[model samples]
Target: MSTIVSARGLTKKYGDFTAVDGIDFEIQEGECFGFLGPNGAGKTTTVRMIHCVSPVTAGTLTVDGSAAGVDNRALKKKTGVIPQEITLDIDLTVYENLLVFARFFDIPKREAKARIAELLKFVELETRRDSKIDQLSTGMKRRLLVARALLNKPRIIIADEPTTGLDPQARHLIWQRLRQLKAQGVTLILTTQYMEEAQQLCDRLVVMHQGKILKAGDPRGLIESEIGKDVVEIRMPPDRDEELLARLGPLACGHERVGDTLYFYCRDGIGLWKALVDLDLPNTVHRPATLEDVFLKLTGRSLIE
Candidate 1:
């Protein structure tokens, strides 16, 4: 449970533009730590620094007791990366792809062969070992990426939007594999925009916006603190806001109007739900407050662009 990654006033810049503003957070060993944000929110930038591919422009960044730097070979050797993009060699067979990657780590020929066999099976691609990367489906390619990352037997794994284009079953399979890795004590550093992914995998996460940390906590704790226990959504015209607020406002802890819907955040939404039902209001829904709710509330529900 010791700190595996730590950053203090961490910052990253590209010439005149700053991609990661001053931010600070710590990741514990053997836990899935997440960086959650929308496109261009610096989640990728922050994690790139952690994995030592991108240089830090300012402040301190450390991983496993060493300062993070572009030339930090020791850190790089023990770290595995599942990049967002599919970086496999399309012309090579599944087995060949892994074979080449193992060489990069200087894994011996005999040992590499043994590990490759185990990994192909681990990702459930044993039957497709001889098949070309181009012949595999998107999910299959993603699984191969997972296997490739593990070839070095890394202590830390950085998964940057690893399940980006996968279907539900494929995504779940990836999740299961990741959980299995975590159970084996691999420190997982994840950067994703998927709130559900963060909630499902992360023991804790930071919600970033405009290159800055807006909030950080365990998912459920953040949801409860920022959004209460339940959410009541009423898809009514905005003009009715005042009328409904007069009657339902006192029963709820907080309320907001976005588009045609009025949202009520309550510690217990049942009472407010009953009030709305008594009013015979149409298009009303009562649901649990989720990480998505906390995300939108803190980062703004509007599109980032």
Candidate 2:
């Protein structure tokens, strides 16, 4: 796979505060990469630098082998961005919004018209192409944003918090479009707080904290390697956390205590369950491990927190 993006010692600082501490990574063509972290963990900062919308404070970066100092316009043309905030113009119709984006690429009028129609259909917004921006549903607006981004037919797409706030069905609709993009071999970089969104879409991911990477790999690989194969949660009194930790030795290969919850991680959750039952340890329930448990294990808290 060819490298589509690369960064070495990438840093961004403001006065005395550092937003992105020196970090380095590469993204290859035709893969969905993710930056997974809580708010203020510098995921957006990284995306801004990649999009060339924010200057790097230090270090070297390149897109498609184009140096940071060269061909930024050419680079931007191949990159499509969906910012954390909505940027649609309320007065423009759905089709018109995309036509404006195509014009920025200096696409010819006749070709731009064809492209806009195709993009609208790709995002499932074809039926509502004439709807005024304000009259469209939230999901429709998001679809339009996606259509606008693809107006130039970019090779790489950057989505920041794509499903931040929407009903479950709306979110799923957006997810569907993203999957379609991947199936067509478009390289994508997604930053999302929603664990399920990242898990379902990303081929590999980096979990960031305090402007640093805590772990990196495919979601399931990171979970199975950083953590173990299984996790068992036992709810107990907040003050009894320490006691639960001590008693977990008979049931867990490794354990962690966060507030009133005791987490047991091991290769076999059912074995731990049988031990807990044999020892009469007070466990509420035993279940399979998930990305949520992996996040809590590494961060010592919930993803939202």
Highest lDDT: which candidate? Answer: 1
What TM value does model 1 have?
A: 0.99
> Over the stretch 120-225, how does candidate 1's per-residue lDDT look in tens digits?
9999999999999889999999999999999999999999999998999999999999999999999999999888999999999999999999999999999999
**What are the models' TM-scores?**
0.99, 0.92
Q: Which stretches of candidate 2 lie over 4 Å from their true place?
A: 69-71, 238-247, 279-283, 302-305
Cα lDDT for residue 168, candidate 2? 94
| Candidate 1 local Cα displacement, residue 81, angstroms | 0.4
Give the number of the best model, judged by TM-score.
1
Error of 2 at 80 (Å): 1.0
Backbone clashes in model 1, listed as residue pairs: none
User: Each candidate: RMSD to true structure?
Assistant: 0.8, 2.2
Which 10 consecutive residues of model 2 have the lowest summed lDDT?
Answer: 296-305
Q: How would you encode candidate 2's per-residue C-alpha lDDT over 196-271 as one tens digit per residue?
A: 9988899988888767778888888887776677777777766766665666666667877667777788777877
**C-alpha root-mean-square deviation, candidate 1:** 0.8
